[model samples]
Target: MSNLSKLESQSIFLLREAYRTFRRIGMPWSMGKDSNVLLWLAQKAFCGRIPFPVLHIDTTYEFPEMLEFRAWAQKHYGLQLIVKINEEAIARGVGYETHDPVTVTHELKTVALQQALAEYQWDALITGIRRDEDPTRAKERYFSPRSSEGEWNYKDQPPEFWNQFALPPKGAGGHVRVQPLLDWTEYDVWLYIRREKIPIPPLYFARNGKRFRSIGCRPITHPVPSTASTVDEIIAELYSTRTPERAGRAQDHHERNAMQKLRAKGFL
Candidate 1:
């Protein structure tokens, strides 16, 4: 099999495993390239039907195009989509200007997700986090468990070499996170998107000469200068550029361990 096929096979295997191991399994769909790719993979794994619910934590600040695309995909696939919003944070004026970017991240994303997970009682959350995306995410596993309160214990993790994984024992009181895309890189994601012809938000394509390298809330995300207008051009740009995949995301730079802090507290 080709490299892409191998990756697809592994992701499909994990998706199936996650469904079998957890009573309540859900996937976090960010409507970004990576997560969307995972969504396509999930469909393939379940024979064109996703077996678990898909959660989208709408901070109410995502790009407008992202919301449009979310609605489109939901209808396209007949998805069991759960739209989550942090109404309390927005009502309290938790934003980039009123609060520190990190604080906003915690309130709008981390805390909101904690509340949703606790109430939903999903035993496993399948997210689209990639190891190469950020330093904090680099410490993740293909199947990592979190505390009942949704706190991540990154310092202590099980080894996942040779395809072996350690799912937290049943009734151990916490849910495991299934990261099928942990091993994929930005280049890999683009290649997979191109190969599979997946639908994605248009913000990634250059408008004039800028495009979003990473997508998040509109308040904290920025577009990088790029001339890439098509998927092939984006793939070529990824091959030639030295910039980090999330270079335009402001939250990563405002605090030294922003992503780590947010992820530890259950931010997507």
Candidate 2:
């Protein structure tokens, strides 16, 4: 089998395992390229129908294109989308400008996600985080466990050699964080997107020699210099590019430990 095919097979396996093992399972959709591919795979896993609710945590700071694509995709795929807004935090102006992006991320993303999970009572959250996207995310496992209150212990993870995952012990009440795309890389995602014909937001394409390699809130994310306007071109660019995927992300530059701090606090 080809490498992308193997990656798809493993992701499908992880998605099924998470659903069968946990009573209530959920998947968070960031509406980015990787997460969108994850959503497509989830539907394919269930025979063209996804069984779990898809999550979209709207901080009201997302790029307009992201919100538009999300809305369209939800209807196009007939997704069971559950949206949660951090209205209070946004209202208080806790954005990339008014405060540390880390603080903004915590208040708007981490805290809001915990509240929604508590209300929904979901035991596991399927995330589309690939290790190659960020150095901090490289520590994640296929079946990483979090505290009952949504705290992630990234520092102490279980051994998972040979596809064996050590699940959390009983009485360690908490939600399980499942990462099906943990092994896929940035180029793998683009390849899969091209193969599957999955629709992604147009912001990823370059416009006048600038394109967003990693998309986030418009204000917090800057586009890199790129002439790659199509998926094929983007793939070719990545083949020789030495730049990190998240280089355009402002938060990563603001602090070295920014992504890890967000993950430890449950920012998916």
Candidate 3:
């Protein structure tokens, strides 16, 4: 098998494993390339129908294009989407424009996700986080467990030897984060999207010589200089680009350990 084929198979297998292992499972879709690929893989794994609901934690500050794409993709893929928002935080005037990045991210994202978990009580949540995306994410296991309070103790993770995985115990009052795309890279994600002909948000492509490599809230995410207007051009650009994938994320620049702090508090 080719490299893409191998990666596809392994990811499909992991998706199946997650379904078999967890009593209740949901996927978090970010409307980004990696999550789009993950959604496609889940469809392929389950014969074109996802067995569980898909959750999207809205911060009320996302780009308008992202929200439009979300609606389109949900209809196109027949997704059972559950949209959650931190109404209390929004009511209290918590926003990226007014509050600090760390505080706003925690309140809008982490707290919103926590509220969803508390209401849904899912056994597992399948996320599209890859190890190569960030330093803190590199330490994640395939079946990483969160505390009852939805905290991640990165230093105290269980071991995963060979292809074996360690699942969180039943009735732990917490959820296991199933990372099916942990081993895939940024380039690999683009390649898979091209191969699968998956649809992604158009914001990723360059417009007026700028494109968002990673997307978040509008106030916290910025675009980088690029001329890659198509997926083919994007793949070619990756071959020689030296820039980090998330260089445009303004929040990452706000603090040295901003992501680590947020991830520990259950930010996805």
Comparison by TM-score, 2 against 3, better one: 3
Query: How many residue pairs clash in model 3?
Result: 0
Model 2, span 1-268: residue lDDT tens = 9999999999999888888899988888889998999998998899999899999988788898898898899999999999998887878878877788778878988888988888898889999998888878999988888888798888888889998866765235588888999999999999999999999999999999899998877778899999999999999999999988998888777877888888888877
- Minimum summed lDDT over a 10-residue window in model 1 is located at 165-174
182: Cα error in model 3, Å: 0.2
RMSD of each: 1.2, 1.3, 1.0
91-167 per-residue lDDT for model 1 (tens digits): 98888878887898888777877777877888889999998998889999888878877888899888877878777
**Between prediction 1 and prediction 2, which has the larger lDDT?**
2
Give me the candidate number with maximum TM-score: 3
lDDT of 3 by residue, 160-190 (tens): 9896877756447888999989989999999
Provide the global lDDT of candidate 2 against the true structure.
0.88
Backbone clash count for every predicted candidate, in the order shown:
0, 0, 0
Q: Is candidate 2 or candidate 3 better by lDDT?
A: 3
Stretches off by above 4 angstroms in model 3 are: none
Angstrom error of the Cα, residue 44, model 3: value is 0.4
Assess the local accuracy of residue 214 in candidate 1 as a C-alpha lDDT between 0 and 100. 91
| lDDT agreement of model 1 with the native | 0.87
TM-score of each: 0.97, 0.96, 0.98
